[model samples]
Target: MTNRKIYRIALEVEAFPGMPTTAAKLLPLLENHDSTASEIESILKYDPGLTANILKLTNSAYFGIPTRISSVRQAIVLLGWKRLLQVVMTICMSPLMNKTIPGYDLPRGALWQHSVAVSVAAEILVNALKIPDADEVFTAALLHDVGKLILGGFVKEDLQQIESMVTKGITFDVAESMVLGTNHAEIGGQILGKWCFPAELVSAVQWHHDPESCDESCNLSDIVHVANTMGIMTGFGKIDQELALEHFGPVADRLGLAPENLEDMAQQTADRVKKLMVSWA
Candidate 1:
């Protein structure tokens, strides 16, 4: 399908079932460098379900706080604004991402697991490399493959052809483009733009598969590219391994990461994913 057709399909879909209005309202607050705990708590209060998820997550073993968190404000205070925003985004997007995507060969919850893994990996890279805008990168990583959700049925239909191209040495995204006329990365970027996400995030999603194509000044796409590849290697999901490895070295180098450092970061990301899975459970 053409890009226009793909976007038309996305627009016709059910408004992405798990996109809470609360998320849209919370975006500005989360983006604000000086946003207060009370400001976050106040917005979350209107969404009882989201508020409950936040409190539950804050008290979970993953957070490891000494006392239980009973209220949104208390959770915010305990988790701090940045961490709280991560939890909220994870909670808000989980339901939509947790389902099976047979087109991509993802079983129920597999995509969600991969997303979490990538998010963790992005966080590790951000801190390790001392990159700024950790929250934006994390959120972008979590939603990096959202286009897969949109393209699932089409991919399922074209699976054999796409696989054949991959077997003939084409990268997965290239195969996807050949078969579907639009790759998941670009579709994901368009979807996020439609959702009113910041341009940084839209660019990250759009260019993660080919970070070299992103603007020279932004490292967010490069960070997500490395994280997504790491997540695939760690078995969060399957993809063309050769294609992934091809980009691995260059992407890591772009972030000034040595192989040893990248390996350590991958291990840290895996551990974080393990703890996060428990919290989700």
Candidate 2:
């Protein structure tokens, strides 16, 4: 894969060299039952800014709690441990996702919007279809475009060429390769692998833009691909001209989504998503 343009682009990024060490320090705490809420709270207490940010988001208009939740402990109790962990992971990666990348035409928070929307879409899809491990699916969908973080500076420099090709009706992945000699999929997978995300998730991001390539072995990645394709269709993160509809055709077939039912489901998902957009947006 080293010679592949996408993989080559990942190689150009200055990835974290001490990620495993940091993971070793923290993973055991999350993995072992010994780490309690108090322990995690104690760690957060020192970082007042972090704690405040978390609390703010928990009580934000997006979450739509009946009453205000003013503390991390209360937020944890209300949101639950699983959701809390997700929030932590989101916060930890904010620096990377929020970084400016002019090449991709992404503003400071553009990637974050896309990431979070895809995550919510994945969860919604999994729940509707009764897909297992929905949280993991949500996590993978959230980070699917993580490669953009690594390729930020590079993409900013060469986006004109990429945009030109995209305007000419070239596929997004093709445009990325043409402009940067790499694409987001390879870049995202490497970052997640280095950070010890589950292998399946890494694979989902690496292959989401191309589900057929992933179906040779299994359908896990295909699930994510469809979720993302739905997001694309619904214009979650962009307002561009018509996107290629072919990306969803075969996957919908595999998933057995009847053509007649699609429009209604899309509307339902959009309505569900709107409720939280006030706070999140």
Candidate 3:
């Protein structure tokens, strides 16, 4: 199908049921640097479902907080607005990301696993490299492959074509673009754009597969690109190995990281993902 047709279909089906209205409302507010904790708690209070999810996650084994967080206000104060927003987004998006995507050969929860892995890896990179805005990078990494959720059926439909191209040495993203008229990263960007996400986030999702081609200089896209590759390397998901390696050296160099950093980051990311999976479970 044409890209336009695929985009149309994505628009129709992209309104995932798990996306809490409260989370949607809170995104812009959280994006504002000046947004106060009270403001965040006020928005979350009205959505009991969202509040419950946040409380559950904050009190999850992943957080290791001793006392139970019974109230949204308490959770907000404990987590702070930045981390609280991350938890909120994670809880809200989990349902959609956790679903099986047979087209991409991701069984139930596989995509979510990969997403969390990348998010963890991105967080590691942010700290190690001293990159600014940890929360933004983590959020972008978590949603980087959202296009795959939208393009699963199309990827499945074009599986044979995709595999054939891969066998002939073409990368997965290229094969996807060739067969489906658009790749997941671009499709994911469009979906996030429709959700009224920030342009930087949309760019990160869109250009993650090919960060070098991004209109702007190195940014979160480069970080997520390396993180996504690390996630696949650590067995969270599948990708063309050769294609992924091509970016590894360039991205690592761009970030001034050595090969050893990636190896350590991958291990750290796996351990963190394992702990976080319990909450999702």
Which tens-of-lDDT digit does each residue in 2-101 have in candidate 1?
A: 6766666567444654456888789788778598877877777688888878877888777789997888777767787788779988998898889898
Candidate rank order under lDDT: 1, 3, 2
Instruction: Give one digit per residue, the lDDT tens place, for model 2 in 52-158.
Output: 77787777765678878888778877887666665665555566576656556777777776676666667666667776554567668777887776676666666
lDDT of each: 0.81, 0.65, 0.80
Best-performing candidate as measured by TM-score? 1
Tens digit per residue, CA lDDT, model 3, 82-134: 77778877887887788988777888888888888888888888888998754
Superposed by TM-score, candidate 3 places the C-alpha of residue 266 at a distance from the truth, in angstroms, of 1.3
Candidate 1 Cα lDDT to native: 0.81
Worst 10 residues of 3 by lDDT: 11-20
- lDDT of residue 195 for candidate 2: 73
The runs of at least 3 residues in candidate 3 whose Cα sits more than 4 Å from the true structure, single-residue gaps closed, are: 1-19, 241-243
Model 2 root-mean-square deviation: 4.0
Output the TM-score of candidate 3.
0.89
TM-score of each: 0.91, 0.78, 0.89
| Better structure of 1 and 2 per lDDT | 1
lDDT of 2 at 237: 61
